[model samples]
Target: LDWSFRTTTRAAQKLPENVEEILTEAALREAHLIRKYDIPAALRVNTDQTQTVYQQGTNTTWNKKGDRQVPAVGIDEKRAFTLVPSISASGELLPFQAIYHGATPASCPDRKSPFYTEAEQLGFRLEPSKSDTYWSTMAMMKSLVDDVIAPYFECKKNELGIEDPDNQYSIWKIDCWSVHKSKEFLSWMRTTHPKILVIFVPGNCT
Candidate 1:
């Protein structure tokens, strides 16, 4: 199986051209199949309690520093890269898996993700808290793969001399969103690529 951590900017810059390249060139060159997909990042929200009081001798007052649920935007841009290379073993090409890591919740602060520490270490400034934007990025990547990369592969298949009719390929773009409210995206994915698998990863409570 092909496994990868979430995407990071640094990681994306270092990956090969396509998923196929990594599978063929990596040590797992003998494997018959490979699996690759983006892992949704974790998210966190502030939960504070508030109290209101009323008294005959004192003025009424209300406190509003209560709980908040914010979506995190972590690791989304860090692992976006293409892979497209295979090596020769025993003079025969083999099936391979390629993956491009996408975003994660750990990268966002409002989401209380952990990736902010790394981003700071890397000299990147954190952005202000905002609405969860992970799914938007996922959709964008899906469009890129569908509109650009897939067609390129079709064109190159003949020139590259690829002859395996059983060879299968897939693309996975991931993001974090509320399961209760993200039905729209879910529906879109189901209608567009019903065969693809979708996995959701939640954030740590602490």
Candidate 2:
């Protein structure tokens, strides 16, 4: 029999213990079967802040005297929101958060609306600063590895009868594309414990 484990950055960090502990428990539970790893939450950033120009119409008109004409026409400048990496608890990578980052016009006629009305209803603005996006992703990833994965293995150490730290068996099934994204966590696993085996599973193969 084969079992698969999936997690995203957010869910990873939310684990009760460190990664090792969770891994150990999972290993013990499925010791009789083959284990496969899958991480659906990994994301890659393709673009940064992009610029967009928008035009607005103002209501400037001449008064009764018509002495002079008022300048009512104007253009509004808007910028494209940066795309950032995000992971869902179910291991889904949501690459795009919002479609637009500028104001909406009352009379605007556009088939596709970039703004996410649902998100706004949830009280979250779509415009996220570039630095915020970068730091948030990194922080969540770090927490998942350090707090969830690590502790999971620790809990299973005794059950696995893994005396030697280096020979311990711990297989990781992550998206083939996410191996690079999780490189830092993998490295940490090897160096910090030295005894645990951190195998990377590409794709969904069990």
Show how many residue pairs clash in every candidate, following the order shown: 26, 25
lDDT of 1 by residue, 1-206 (tens): 79775433323334334645544443242122232321111111111111111221222233455636433434122322232222222232222112223254344344345765554543332321123332223444344335443433344444455454124333232224353127765676667645333432222211
Tens digits of lDDT, candidate 2, 21-91? 65566556444322332211121111112233355333444466756654555523233333333332335
- Listed in order, each prediction's TM-score against the native is 0.24, 0.29
Top candidate on lDDT is: 2
In model 2, the runs with Cα more than 4 Å from the true position are 1-131, 134-136, 165-167, 177-186, 201-206
lDDT of 1 at 60: 24
Q: Which runs in model 1 stand beyond 4 Å of their true positions?
A: 1-145, 148-173, 178-181, 204-206
Q: What is the C-alpha local distance difference test score of candidate 1?
A: 0.33
